[model samples]
Every structure is written in C-alpha cells, then in structure tokens.
Target: MAKSDTDIPAGARRRLLALAQERGASLAGLSELLGRNPSYLQQFIRKGSPRKLEEGDRRTLARFFGVDEGELAEAREKSYGATPPLGAGWVEVPRLDIGASAGPGALPAGEGAFDAFRFSRRWLAEHGLEGARLSAITVEGDSMEPLLNDGDEILVDCTERPFRDGIHVVRLGESLMVKRVASAGGGRLSLLSQNLAYPPVSVDVADVDIIGRVVWKGGRI
Candidate 1:
C-alpha cells in the first residue's frame, strides 16, 4: 500500500527540505529537473501525491542530494521524528523561500516565508553581521553574473539602511530585482550590473525601495 501524503514522516520532509536549502533549490525546480511536473514534489510535500516516490524519482533525488537511496526509503518507512535541537553558539538566520532576480525583474506570486538556517555564531560575528536583520534569497537571473550566479543563495542585511555603492536588492515599481546600486545623490540612484549588455538603469531613490544590501552568497557546489 502506498503511503498517504499526510503519512509522510516529518523527518523525511525535513530531510528533503534541508537538502533543497543546501542546494539552493526549490521543490518545484527539483521536480522539473526530474522530468516531472513543476508541482510534483510540491504536491508530495504539501499534499502527498503518488503515495510513494517512484523508484526512478527517488534514485535521482537521492543522488542529487548526495544521499544513499536507502536513506530516503528509510524516511518513507519511519514515522515523524524529532529533529536535533540546536546547540549553543549557533544562530539561525532566516532564509526566505523566495527568488531575487539578479538580472531582469521578477514579480513573486506572493510574499516569502522564512525557514531559518542555523549558522555558527562565531562565524557570523567574525563577519560583523547581525543575525536579527539577516535574510536569504535565491538568485534567479544572470545580470549580477560573476558575483552572484543563478541558483546561488545570497544573504541580505535588512538593517543596512542608507544605501551607498554596492550590490543591493531593490523593489522598483512592482518588480523586485538585485543589482549594483550607486548613489547619484540628489535623490537619484543608479542600478548597474556586471554584465555590460544590461546597460545601466537610473531611478530616483524614492521611486525604488531598497530591500537590503547583499552581504553573502553561496551555491550548492
């Protein structure tokens, strides 16, 4: 008998989500990579479909996640389980399940939800970043190439008010984008990109809201 979606073990779901976050991927993107509908994995996570992942799908996911196929299978057979509690000296920073375009603008369907990722407090302190104002987002385009690649996850410092010269995530009009912003002063700001093909876009500082300044970037590899 196939397991119902509601029967998916909590540990299994957590493991999958952790793997996805580590790889800077979404369930929807992972489903497409496996040649399934974009929503296949999402349904399994949120609604439980196909009862159990087919052997091929399971194998592919296991390899991509750098885990043994048996591990995933084990998760399916087990019941919901408790996760390890975070140890002292570790701080969890919110990584929003949202994509920020480094190239063209993107209009997210809805606001993002944050699922915190634990980091070493020492490491964060060394970098001079406050975990309170830190949030993460996935890069979706190539405009900020060389620095931020597609699929790379970036941490934005929401408390870094007073924009200056740096790469920033901003919401211009209805579209949100990540770009290299330079202050033109006099109430104007310039959005630049590493890719010369994009040219430069200038806008009034008031017209575009600064989301945050990007402080860190990471990718699966």
Candidate 2:
C-alpha cells in the first residue's frame, strides 16, 4: 500500500534524524542550514509531521549526506520503525566578502576580504557543488543580464573545471569576464556574451584563469 505523505513511518523520521546527526547537522542547525525558520523545523521534528520537500530540498539534503536522492528516499522508507533519540551536530557557515561580482576579475575592495556571513554547515555539506568549491560574491553589471541580475547572490565553485559549453567566470590579464566558453582550438578559446551590446572576446588558454563555475543563483523575489 502506498503510504500517505503524512504517514511516513516513525523509522524514517528517526533515520533522518540520525542521518542529519551523522552528517554533523542538528535540528536547530538544519533549519538554519536550509535558511528556514528554526521554530518551524523544531515543530516539524517534534511532531513528525510531513512537508513536501522539493527537488532542490532533496538535492540539498542529498548533498549534505554525500548520497544520491534515490538512496535517501530508500533509507527513509526502510528505517520507518522507531523514533531515535534526537542527536545533534550542525554548524554554521559565515558569509565572507570574497570578491565583487563585476564581470569576473573585480576583486573585493577595502573591508571586503576577510568579511564573512553566518551559514549552516549542514546546508553547505548538502548543497556544496561537486569539484568546484563554494565562493560567495555579489553580482555587479548587466552584461550577464536576465540570467544574472545585479545584487543577486551567487555561489561559485572555484574547484570546477571549465568546459567548452556553459557560463563561466574567467580572468584574462587584468580583466575578469563572465561569459560562455567556446573552444577555438590550438589552445585557444572564445568568450561569448549573451547581451548583444557586449562584444565577444577570444584568448589563449594560457592567459585565461577559471575562477569558478556558477552552479546556482540566489536572488530576492
């Protein structure tokens, strides 16, 4: 029989709690980890009530556990027998002024470097991009408009490598640019821009530095 959304067995909840603990996450921390209200999460765990977790939410948790979504779902289903004691181990991540998102090469100015914001370790563990590391920066110009608007918060994975396709932030000489990468052969590549007003630029592979690959974009509605 298909279980109702609210009918998720007790085992599943316990396992979830355990899993969060194992991943160094606490209930209070998980709420903050996901940028959710702490009281809401407390109620959620205390009541064993169900909430529809979106794909992004699932992805966030899956990433935190270092497991895939399918695996997480299966674990939940299999572990639905008992409520385990609440275990806790969630930490917070602080936001740091790493750089300014003007094109790409614009580094942070005075009081920018070493500045940090608080974030949940649980959230970072789950949603951290693969290969590419997370680096927070505020968007600046309109050259990469529509897709990336000014003042939008972005997570860049610096550890990621650049492929011929997809948008990327690159540094060429003194200028940094956010554009599409296209292989031009002979150790060269072309940087393309979406905005018609901006002209595309070509360069040698040696001169270009891939600062990071933008995996997700966060903005105010």
Candidate 3:
C-alpha cells in the first residue's frame, strides 16, 4: 500500500540515515552543523520526532547534499534515469582545498582544486555574489559559534576584494584564516571572533592579504 502523506517522512528519515552514512558523517555531526543539540537528528530519525524537517533545515540538507530540495522527501533514486532538472538559472562554483579557521591559527593551503558547487545564479546575484570570483572552503574550530560552526563549508567571493567591515578569509604568512574583519581607521584591520573568550587580532592591512569575503555557508544537517 502507498504511504499517506502523514507517513511519508518515516521513509525519508530512513533514507537520510543512509545518506549520512554514505557521506561518512554521523547524526550528531549533522545536528551540530545545523546549530541543533547533538541528539536532534538522532531523535528525529529513531523516533520520527518531527515527521518533517523545518523548511530551512530541508533547504540546508538539500544544499549540503547537492540535490533537489524535494529529493529529501522523495527518498529514492531517480526512476528510469528521469531525474528532476534544475532551472536554467542554476550555476556552479569551484571549491578549493582550503580551510578558514573560526578559532585561533589556520590550515596551510593544500592542492586547491575540486569540482564546483551548484547554486542558482539568481540566488548568487541576490547576495551580490559573482561565480567567477567565488570558491568554497571549510571552516574549522568553534570560535565562530552561534554564527559559523566548526566544519561548516563557506563560499568566498575572491572578487569582493578591497575589504570592508564583515566576515572574511584572510592570509597572514603561510596560513589562511576566517574572522570578522573591521576597518581600524589607519589602513589597519582587526580580526574579531564571535566567541567573547577569544580576543581581537589587529594587523596592518599591507602586512596581510585579504583572500575574499565569506559570502555564504552550509553544513550537513
């Protein structure tokens, strides 16, 4: 018998569990990435607690998996190779093998190339983003919590240079880092953390290289 709409999400939940495993991530990791308690996804999956995800959470999961948002509910592979098509406005941006830290210090640059991430061109334009100057990087540590959590993948607009006050990826010496950047009135910049326990870092603008502004972020959830 076909499942009723009210019962559809159980199968979806089961599929999501499998998807997480295929991605080599855990329920706890997905929950934390969505800014939910560690057991949030566990409860939802094991108990069918929510039945359906909130709209925002659904969108997040879709973006993270690089799939159509509706697929999460469909919870099955495309039939007869008849996959849903994306709109013509959709575009993809490259993701580099780079990381930006929300805490202290950073990751050394590695081989910087990967398949690009797909997004709607209209959505990018809405956010003042240009695909040519954009790339995705991972965020490490929890210092940017309540904003950008650890393991979050953020999109950076390399063309959005000549930095102003906002979140940005910056390079100092051999390392690249992510922090809130604000002008210091003397051709200097201050890197601040969302976590109060971490102190602000000051640096001369000329002494460091501003990689790009953090335009967007997505994590598994």
lDDT of 3 by residue, 129-180 (tens): 6344667778988888879989899887777346578998887765678899
Clashing residue pairs in all predictions, respectively, total: 0, 15, 0
TM-score of each model, paired residue for residue: 0.58, 0.48, 0.57
Better of 1 and 2 by lDDT: 1
Per-residue accuracy of model 1 over 1-221 as CA lDDT, tens digit each: 65554565665555676688789998999999899999888777665565557656767999898897545543422211111225678766656666788777987554444466677778777888634366677898998888889999887777746657899888887677999999887989899988887989989876787777888888976
Residues 28-135 of candidate 2 have per-residue lDDT tens digits of: 777677777775445554564444343355557777777755443433221211112222533222233443344534643321223333344555457763222454
Which residue pairs show backbone clashes in model 1?
Answer: none
Off by over 4 Å in 1: 1-87
Between 1 and 3, whose TM-score is larger? 1
| CA-only RMSD, every prediction | 14.6, 18.6, 16.1
TM-score of 3: 0.57
Instruction: Name the lDDT value of residue 91 in candidate 2.
Output: 29
